[model samples]
Target: MTKLIHVAAAAIFNPEGQVLLALRSKQQHQGGLWEFPGGKVEANESVLEALSRELDEELDIQIDHAATRPLIQVPYHYPDKSVLLDVYKVSGFSGVPHGAEGQPLEWVDIANLEQYDFPAANTPIVNALLLPQCIAITGNANGTAEYVKKSVAAISGGAQWLMLRAHQLSSSERTALARQIRATIDAADGVVLSLNGSVAEANDCGVNALHLSSDKLMVLNTRTEFRGRWLSASCHTIEQLEKAVSLGLDFVTLSPVKTTATHPEQPAMGWQAFSELVNAYPLPVYALGGMTAEDVDQSCQSGGQGICAIREYW
Candidate 1:
């Protein structure tokens, strides 16, 4: 087995939401590529300790550990080495960051990160950083009219990302609802709309993204044929999450993090277990089930991309 080298990295963010990235030295491994500022973890140090040390050594800045939120841990295999990157979002820090090791540093807007060349393993990290912290899901509204009204309200109330979910509706009915919601969101100028349906339905409805059910996710061997559309999936167990990652879905929603009225009998995976489950998986994960907008920080702390909710978010 290839031994995994553990690395601690920080996605240091300025107040403007731009992430700090460093240009790798040509002499080093993965040379000339842009990467998050970090280094290999020493044998005896904790991930957090290593992150703090690496920032201080590489950037000459003091990291505020309290403000550090767990992001994603990606395991990537190279021809000569394998690395398990433990990444964190550093929202609070002291001192201006400058490259102390002679590597160049730049603050790039999250949306424009794709314009820069990054290692293949850094792709999911970029996605997680760019995605919204709250994903509002449309609940069981009484009718199409009610659903449209709620969708508009959700967007107006600051939901930049939304998932139109009406599993009980027929294919045509779901497609129509998705189209209606997409129209409303587009008019709002910046909100992203993801429809909860099949690839064919999403294409027919002209939606911007597709959210697959866990069942559908498990059966897929590759990504769907929706070109230019973002793909996401619902996940429960680590097996489902692995499947979603293998399919290269943009993100995933891990459900029932907390017990809900809809499924009182289904066991709730408390925050601790949720954190453990998503600890090192690369794909961004949204904590779903009985979540509210207020849980966003806690979700991030627990290694989730954000919180996804229906009633509470709407």
Candidate 2:
């Protein structure tokens, strides 16, 4: 029988939409497969404190300004023992990453993560890496195809993922246009597509993924009946992020990373404050709202998956 243990882990992403994975030394348990850099949480140490300490020891790098946000806290069993892992998104840090612990490490781009096998508990975490940082089309009132085309151009111009949010349109119209955009994305062989709603239908379609609305994400339950497809959500609160984890979401958006013209009245959490909130849990979190690729370095500092922008990247 396996005994349960508790530990903390970190999913560290870089500015180029890649994440850091470490290969344990031959002396360590689970010696071959790669893992996010972290270790068992010590008594009396806060999760973030433990994360910072572990990274410094294991990687031999100072966490000069790292945002170690709690992501998903889950229990996983290895044949001999089980562990309650405290996962965090490590947004930023200084110095080149070296395995001071004598382990090998790789900085993997999102698309390349599947190449390495990870522990079963970290499987969901791996999928989270594949989720896109959506750049939504700002104007739905205009012609759908034209707007979508522009979005595609933006995607070619470095925007990798997009969400077609025709919120006010009737379901049928939205579906029609979304389908067209889906085809366009497919033809391009580059950009990924996600629809705002109708996931059940989106599943039937060939689009790369589905983006759940805040309302829909709230009432959802059970892991989405999906495999090999990315699922994402818009989360403005901690509660929503929890629900997303429960629903087996691939990744989530922590929005308004900065105050933006998009939502003038809504207060932005800024990078530092958001990092603290994120430090509370471990999940693949994107720093959404008024962010750009330039903010990527900063966002990763806050434990973010990457930056999801409106005016910034788009």
> For candidate 2, what is the lDDT?
0.71
RMSD of candidates 1 onward, in order = 1.9, 6.0
Q: lDDT tens digits, residues 148-224, model 1? A: 89888998888888888888999999998887877766878668999888888888988878899998787766785
Across 189-229, the per-residue lDDT of candidate 2 in tens digits comes to 55777777766656655556777888888876654553326
Q: Can you list the residue pairs that collide in candidate 1? A: none
Per-candidate count of clashing residue pairs (backbone under 3 Å): 0, 16
| Model 1: CA > 4 A from native | none
Error of 1 at 124 (Å): 1.8
Best by lDDT: 1
lDDT of 2 at 161: 78
